[model samples]
Target chain A: MTGTLFLQTLVDGLILGGIFSLSAVGFSLIFGVLGVVNLSHGIFVLLGAYLGLALKEAWGIDPLMAIPLVFGALFVLGGLVQITLVSGAVRRGSLMSSLLITFGVSLMLRDLIILVFGPDVQSLSSSWLFDTFRIGGVIVDGARASGLIASLLSLGLLSYVLYRSKVGRAMRATAQQDFAAGLCGIDVKKIYAMTFGVSAGFAGVSGIIVGLINPFTPFDDTHWTLNAFVTVVLGGVGSPVGALLGGLMLGGISTFSSQYVGSLYPNVFIFGALLLMLIVRPNGLLGNAYKGSV
Target chain B: MNKQISRRTALGLLGATMTSATALRAMPARAATDGVIRFGGSLGMSGRYAETGLNIRHGYETAIKYINEEKGGVQIAGKTYSLELGIVDDASDPARATTLIQRQVDEGVDFFLGSYGSNVVLPCAGITEAAGKVTVQVGGSADQIFTQGYENIFGFFPRASRAWVTSIEFFKSIEPKPKTVSVMATNSAFSKLNAQAAAAGCKEIGLEVLDVLELPEQVTDSSSALATLRARTPDILITTTVDQNSLVIARQMIATETNVPLLYQFLGPQLPAYRESLGAKADGVVMQLPWDESLEFTDPTFGDTQSYIDYYNATNDRPFSYHTVGASSCITTYIEAMKAAGSVDPLAVRDALDAIDIVTAFGPVNFTEDGDGDPILMGAKIGQVQGGEIKVVYPENLRTAETLYPTPTWAEKG
Candidate 1:
């Protein structure tokens, strides 16, 4: 309606884009390095948030301080989860079975979470964080600002690991060609496990940030997962930078539409956009640059 | 001769005493007065409808605890006996709910308190009825729950359609005659049912219904629904969804420059999340609530809105959400019925519930058996979200505060 309003909406979109980018990056990492969908990525986010919430509220741990602890915890949890459930499917030697196996694992984790967490919407109430900053007469939530920061941090760390570590090299090798990598003396299983763990650890970080930003219900998992999927797809499924651009684009479009038109129709718009993308740029923004395909 | 006679007499007395003691010990562990009144609860404590289930469970448990403490036991035939409660988590699954109900029936549960969702309760009602057990649909608002006409099925919550009519009566009080209504829902059975009932109610009241859209349950984006409605320049928008979805919808509506008068069904938009997310957009959104601060009940502290809010906030410590409200209310109702019935006898509890007036956090609840034998409780209040808070603005005397948005000029005609 006004210049100030439009600017405010754009700023809001940027913050949301940051969150989308953070969440989708993990999914992208897992797919790029491990060639697995890891369908339970959403559940891992939930678990991470719940764990963070529990630590802060139940055990009196500070939310910020709990991040490193959560990251470490989820790293081990991810490895164990993959070893126990996905291992069986992997051993069976069918690519399609991996998806099915992960889907089942997701379902089981979802139910198990319900059993432990019950059916209540939980939040670590931080009213002090509800403050807003007026930038050029446009308002933005203070907590969302912090969330964007956290998301960027997670994304940066993930990128660093991918580009600068021994594990990263091994992961890249496997992703390029698993058989050749195995012949090159890279333990493919260990690389896959580590990549999954890293991906989940990033998800954990996103979860902590999200928990601070919004009230989480277990049912919201589907929305988050789908959002991540859409982000991954738009970003070329495996490119870190592509995921970032895709998140920003979708986030900006959705937020702008929500402000200018209506928020309810974003899903329809997203689907339409996806269809257009499929036709126009099947390889996505960065294409094969980020993904070393098998 | 004297010693022999004394010894024989003593032996006879000892033998008689020993036999009587053994007979006393051999009797059933619980006296017939303590006859096991097995009450079964097949509840959805997890999944989409978990909040309602959990809240109702709290009410039921607390009431049971109070009843036992006050009377020292359940009063039956002018005698007191201990009460036992058994429950199963149905996870909002209809099949699981049915199985749980049957399992409880086999375990000899006298009365059944079913969960909050219609999908689970409807099927569970059939299983309980088939087993000849009386079932109280604890907090389910499905209109058909009563109309099913099963002799043993009773809906503790008021019918959704009736509630909608009452809410509209309040809406009618808004200035210009409201028109161009938009109906949005989560597509869940209960949410859809509420939306359908509201649409029907609006039609009967001669209001224009525009843009009835059903969104998936976890719709994070509500802008499209708002934009579509905005295109029509609707005077009032009605939402039949949970607090989260409602807040998102309302906020998006405001963002889209369509700040029309709004009405909501059982799901509230006054929750902290809604308020926080909607920010200034939360003001003046009207909704239907079973309980309002203005409504007083016979239970000194029981009927006050604050008591429920306090208990809920004390238990949850967050902003009051409808999920918690509905859940707690249902649980509280069941517990009160159990307390009154005392013996855990399903028939007795159902009879007690039907006969006695229930004073909950909402208001006076009086159930009349329908032709199909389900109890129909008729009571509702109109609330509006103001400054991130839900306040009553209905029935004049029942109004806790003023209505937010005077009906838009466009709504004046029909």
Candidate 2:
């Protein structure tokens, strides 16, 4: 029975890790290539959830089915924000300017969410996503399973785009030397904007997964943003594989700490683990995926 | 005819004067401050508590509207003055709430309306107490708020877990009596006190206490905790958290197939989203409400519980909730105390409140001199979701339907 509980804990951690990896991958990518520390990353995630909710409520579109629509919507939105707000800060060349502007942008977006969504807790769901299955002595539910599958696929897509696609090489080149990439006839600013858009698109997709598992409100953005930063630091900066490792490790630490030590003790453990990892590997386990970026 | 005017004639003028917008707030009395009773507070107008805080404001507004527009405001020392509610959005931040309350105190506001959540209430209540002004709080019910010996902070909510203890008596009365209970709670101050009190209640009632697991603040997953509860297979599962957190716990429970005979929640089931979230699976889940339609407490302002509900239904901007009732009761309590004290002086009103014991639209209010947790006014009657509607099912006389005792298994609910 104890072994089963431990195994169930492990399984839950893995599911949660998939979600965390998906959520942070966008933040990691932006942090890797753009080096902007996009604080509004969580807003993009929440925007996705709200859009998914709108689609589901209006037309009975399942959250999974609403993903492409949400992704498209947020990609455009994220690009505009980068071009207008973040790009200004980036051009200013002040170290803290981008962070400050993004933070400001995040606050405005949060208010915008409240204005539209009416400041109430809302959720997205589907009748088909309500299944519970037991394999051996472990239990896994449909919402989380679906979330995991969605997250992995999204992460896989992101990985393929970053490592295999021509646009991927351009992004890496821009991350290495913006001046050199511009001289190579690559539009550095455009690459940065696309990376930001892709990052936002992934964040939105994760929001759909998150909404599947739990209810959310406009105020919940802070939690997602902080968790993404921690995941990036723990796993390795700016890589999908690092995000997965960090997310999975964070999930394991969270669930096991909750089960064994105490439920409220996970934050303490999470921070302690983060501090230890920072000491051991300043750039994270796999190290900065794009080392020359920052 | 009164005040040299017929009541119907006065109402006609008022009806014509009232604009189409009933989203009216900061209601300034048409009859100016012959004797003004100033009320103000910082509310969670823009964060997680934005909706709830605004509902509380509507509750205050509803009472003030009925009193000023209908009853011609408060009659104090042979002079009548209308109630004015001045509020600022604190965004549910504790430090901001504290600062906003102190600012109101500096501005010489007479009375304070409490913020919605425990986090905000704890800090702001101290500032009000220090200013020697009385704050009638609605939502924050952590027992320490009262036990800390602040005479100025009056709470509508009793001890955080008073209902949990009371519900035990109801639970024990059911046949096929439950012998074991498991508790899950968030780590919020209110929920911590709540879960502890509930565990104690189960034990005192001779039920075997399984585990009382605490979920983290902003918990993303509770699989291990739910799995533990499922393993123990307690007959009853009591979850303590705000409505949002409750959704997460319930979704996980359903997803994991953690079947407890009875699923009892502190906050979620009263909400429509609870039913919408769980669909048919919400059936048989139980909680208690501080105010309900069946309550017959006569209110001086709204006339009775039903009348207040009528006013709330007619004019409130937010959805129907016990919170609206509690917020109205905050205003009603102030008005009654003012009438008793017969003066607009803050100290006089404070003394009146300390000595007053009256049943408002919400329920009975009898504050112990120490102002520590009082169960008499906690007044949360047990309710269960039956046929997709929440119905009272405890304390025999208040039972709208029989208890879904030994609630059906998850598959059985399906």
Candidate 3:
């Protein structure tokens, strides 16, 4: 391939990588703190997009301007869901039950969104952001570029919260050893709820970015969810940084394969790479000593 | 042509027939009068294709609305009544559609209009047909539906499988014939069937098949598909995609900077999303379709499309899609058949559907028996998407505009 085309693929891949990374980090966060896989994470993202769309269409609010509203709404929704359903699952310590409940919630959420938004693919006029920014004869759309920036910013903020904040410390303590952390005055249950809420909020925030980049339908939730899983596994299960790197890597591989091999075989390449990664580096690059251990 | 059964009484008869399947064949023939014939439609309400489904629904409703306003409704024997139409959201689910069809049938509807996808239509039509209700498929073109030999079912949309060979014919008729072509499709039953059929037809025409790519059904992105195209770098890329997926695929092809022309069989650039997403990239994308708005058809209803477009704009605040074109065709075709039969008898409507030459806003449309003993319609217009317009360019008599983009050099180069 020519240098120009290769560069073009890389740039596009990075933008996509940014999206995958954003989606994966949120999933890993919930998995890390609560030990509950948020299967409905993709639905939260879709919900956020739809909320933004509804706000835009109904109240004439710009999608970008309505981002906070969308994020807040989903955050509250996630909190309610966590208190009612997820907390119960975490309390029981049944991972399989958590998976089933979350999957059920995901399907219900998908159906509800369909009922509310209708089954049409909706998109905003992204011409404001979809414009080509040229770099060395290769053009990358600004929407994707903006999404990448937003993803990085979100990740950075998440890192600060996890490392520096009071809730962050409790979350880490609870995740490492819940009984010990409970004895040390950290409310393990509360940490789980807050962590899940934050995780779900991230999902919503990233969903808005996704909507800005591409048209979205309710059914697309599953695909986004699946990609996030692959990213988390690839980056390092239960590790936020690992999820980020994994997302970017998977995105790069998939986009490159689509550009060079065949768009048709990108999934095969992605899963194949995941298989190789699993075999060679089970903990992933920059992953924790324990990945699926917890 | 003038049967003695009235449309309202036909509904009553249908209700009686559905009450017991055994009563379906023995419905009493009542005296016919042209009344406001109500036909109920169940289609993809909200799903991946809600936009296309809604457009098709608008087309049918518009045709019905116009016929009622202008022609005073379909004439039977001597009297005339306006047409009343009702549509329900099936959401493209078969089980939900079965319930909707049953509910509509129980409500004493005269005829039933089916949806755009086979997975939705096959079971829905079976329910309506089992009730001995005349059903017309508007959006869906599954070959099996027609081949099963159900007497109550009639199809308005051209079969998807047949369009490929017609597209090949159109390609051959072009001045500079395209030699090397690549095919790609999402591995859905509908898309795969179309892609495989088109590739086979291309090979039969002695055109070199450079590559064929099949992707998973839920391909969110198209980077890998674009790379494969760049690798083979064929002259034209033939793809069978529906809704945003196709638009995404097109955008990826453009984003990747591969300028190979595209030949799409299922969806055309008549969709606003297709043009909006691809912009300048859409130029030279050839779409095979059966209808175009610019055609100077003698049918007075042809002019009604503009009014329908206005209606859709007024209702949805957007222009009508190509799907609306098919939708309107379905409604008009059904009305004409009902007019010919002069009664809502399911078997009579079926025979009328077979016999009538439907002069639609789109073009002359009617079905003929195919090799599998199924009713399949033939013909498609070759339109090139250029400067955001899907301009019709083939079939000299029906040509609406000149080819938008010249056949790109990529179509002939090694």
Candidate 4:
């Protein structure tokens, strides 16, 4: 590839990496804190995008301006779902039951989305940020650049919340050992609900960013969920910083593989890398972020 | 061609014929008691292609109304048989689609209608081709589908390879005509084939082929490809993409300012969702389509283009699309072939389909033995989305609007 082409791919990879990182941090959090794989995570993201789209079309609200609305709606729904379904599923059969329940809920919500929005692909357009900025020979589109900024800000805020707050301390304690944390005066169930809510809300925030950069359909939920899972696996299962490392790695691998290797080989390369990572370091590059010694 | 039957009644008749399969198998696809001829197959009604599948269903249902009530049914050897549709939702699953076709074949439904996209049609047609059943479809355009020597599978649409091959004349007419071109194709079987064919066509017509950018299957960005375009800056950019890919790539192209003088998407711009997403940005972006509403063609089936549009609009909640007509022509061709052969026999009708040239609501119909459609009819017209609507911009005589040559770049439009 030419030097210019290489530089462009590198820039594109970083932007894509930002999107992947923000979209997955919540998934990593949920997986670590609850030990319940949230298969329905992707739908929350889609719900945010759809909500943004509806707001845009119905009232001429910009997608960027509607992120808070989308985030609030999904956060409440996620908390309620954690209390009602996820907690009940965990009670019935632990992690496997939770997994199945999340999968079923994902399918149900996916169908609901189709019914509400139709199965057509949709993209978000912003009146405020639709321009192409150029730096010498490099071209940066406004949609992607805006998405990258949102992702970074969201990630930075999430880090502050996870490390510098009492709630963050409780969440980490519960993630490490819920029984011990409960004995130590942490309200384990409430913490779980809050973690799930935060994870889901962050997922929704990322979804709006995704909609800004890429065209999405209801069926794309599974793809987003899977991507987040891979990000966690490649970086470290439970850390925002790990999700960032993993997402950027994935973004680079995807772009380089598609550009230099072949268009058809990105998935193969990604999965192969995932398998290799698992074999080399089961705990991941930085290891679990929250889990402490039992 | 005067009588009108309730389209709902035709659907009920379609359902009614399912129970009379014992008589259907004993006879040659004809139910003696109800005079109902069953046409069944699997379509993607609830999956990735659900929208196109629903449109095809409307096309099939509408054609059934015309065949049974207006055209007085399929006349063959002094007997008439009303058409009944027996379709199942395959949900775009290749294995399930083939299995459904096989199930219908086992149950003795001889005539088959095709589903949308090559993925569904490829396997479904394989089942019908093996059963010695005739499948008249509009979706299977990949050259491998035809070159597979599947004689029973007839594509009533443009072959994937001939997409740009058919556009040669149109390109020749461009003002300050293009000399260099680039291609960006997604990872679908049809898209890849169409892109390769476009490159070949460019070479044939002496246009310099800068590059063929095969986009990642789940592409969110195209920076590397855009950079190549920036460096090369080809006069024209040809992209082979479907609705989703088109929207994503088009958005990316606009953002990256990877603007060319002309940009053409093979399929995406014609879809409603893509048009809605792009809005006025869709204008000047030319696309290739098998049928447009403006073609001045007349046939006994739907009279002409205007009537077809009217009937479609009267029934469907949405505006008319080209695929609806393509779907309707499948039934029209089967009826016309059976009438021409004067027999309801599967082999006889298939042979007659190979020979007869008849006009339908969609256009002309004549399937080559290799299962290709009438080339003259399936020209895949060049359509430029003008004034927020697609209009024919080529083949001079069928031109509905003037060709917006040297399509405005993204920067120019902005």
State which docking tier applies to candidate 3.
acceptable
State residue B401's C-alpha deviation in candidate 4, in Å.
2.8
lDDT (tens digit, per residue) of candidate 3 on A184-262: 9988777777777787788888888888767788878877788887898788766667777898898899878877776
Give the B-chain TM-score of model 3: 0.82
**Top model by DockQ, which number?**
2
Task: Give the Cα lDDT of each candidate.
Answer: 0.66, 0.83, 0.72, 0.81
Give the per-residue lDDT digits (tens) of candidate 1, residues B97-204.
888788888877867766767777777877877777876655566767777776676665566666576676765777767766768888677788888887887777
Error of 2 at B170 (Å): 1.9
lDDT per residue, candidate 2, B325-414, as tens digits?
Answer: 888888988888888988878889888888878888778887766553357565578888888888888878777899887777766776
* 1 versus 4: better lDDT goes to: 4
List candidate 2 stretches off by more than 4 Å. Answer: A287-294, B1-33, B161-163, B372-374
lDDT of 2 at B37: 74
Q: Write the per-residue lDDT of candidate 2 for residues A1-294, one digit (tens) a residue.
A: 999998999999999889999999889888888877888888888989999999988898988999999999888888899998899876776659879998998999998988888787888878866687889999888998888888888888887887899999899888788889999999989998998899899999999999988888898898889899889999887788889998998888989998888888989999999999889887887648344432
Index of the highest-lDDT prediction? 2
> lDDT score, residue B273, model 1?
48
- Candidates 1 onward: DockQ, in order: 0.21, 0.64, 0.38, 0.55
In candidate 4, stretches whose alpha carbon ends up further than 4 angstroms from where it belongs are A1-6, A92-95, A260-264, A289-294, B1-33, B65-80
Order of quality (TM-score): 2, 4, 3, 1
